[model samples]
Target: MNGKGTKARWWARTATTFVCVGAAVAATAPSAFAGATGCNDRTCIAVAGSGLRVESVTASTTWNGDFNGHLHIYGGGIDRNSATGFWGYHQKFTVPVGRDLPNGSVLCAEGWEHTGGGLQLRGRACAEVHF
Candidate 1:
């Protein structure tokens, strides 16, 4: 109807289109460390070595006497799957990695537990450290 009305409508449509496009891009974007290492959560830990070796891997969950924990720590084409006899608040497993791993290698671990009901996942995370 008027110049002011037309400009306002155009701006609103442009903003809406930008927001939708941004959401789509974020949904399709890859993670910064895909399948690699991020130990942001307090429940999981990935213990890496100075070089290409990882000394140990640890995970934790709520203390449940009837639960047992399982950890799968892997990187650089190396994987270590381990389990615990009983469920404690913290569970650590040893994964002796040699010095043949490459730099910038990512180590990730998935932690789960065998509970009274069924198998439950604790958390999955990765961590990176340099010498």
Candidate 2:
């Protein structure tokens, strides 16, 4: 009945509407990194090489051991040393491509675990960069 009461009710309704809209949008929207590379099982990997001269590698492991493993990245114009002592739930590695990769170029990465004085495969993943 009062002006203040009407204004308060309007603000509350507006807030509720915004919340509902946000939830709806989130549910319907696709993943931001839907094209990202991913791996499964004891280890996981994701790569994004959309930038020039730099590529990102994300490696993760669920294995609880004395030594988690190492991240190896290869292919393209990027050649770097493997990451050692990759413990914990995840580890990130980066590679510089020196230049933009040609269209349909593929980059591969893998996680290796040390077992019984030998290296064993944990998880492997790869991604293709398109020019």
Candidate 3:
């Protein structure tokens, strides 16, 4: 295999291991936040908004297995989702640092499901935040 392919496989393996460890930790841990939820689904988790100033946003989807959602930021600003035809998908976003959002700048994920779509959301997005 090529060097890129080998590196990708190694990364995937490491990521999978991290996910498993995270799951185990979550299963035994107790959360302090009342409104927080965690998953790889419709509502993933509650990101702490305390002292957080959002600076930017970016997202990506690795495979076409499940999700095809758009992120609605700050209420009205729309950021469409990305998909790689037949195999992969990806997306990126940018947000201002001081923009206010629900529950500390909520990023709403919305999508549709069909014959090729299931209910899983394997992809995620992240933003730079300053406290």
The top-ranked prediction according to lDDT is: 2
lDDT of 1 by residue, 20-50 (tens): 9999999886533212234433345546444
lDDT per model, in order? 0.59, 0.61, 0.40
* Leading candidate by TM-score: 2
Q: Estimate the lDDT of model 1.
A: 0.59
In Å, residue 86's CA in model 2 sits off its true spot by: 4.0
RMSD of each: 10.4, 10.0, 19.6
Deviating ranges (above 4 Å) for candidate 1: 1-42, 51-67, 116-118, 129-131
Q: In candidate 3, what are the lDDT values of residues 9-89, reduced to their tens digit?
A: 999999999999999999877533222223233322233333333333333233443344443333324354434322224
Candidate 2, poorest ten consecutive residues by summed lDDT: 31-40
Residue-level lDDT of model 2, residues 54-127, one tens digit each, is 35655555545224567677766655546577556644565544355655656666667777788887766666
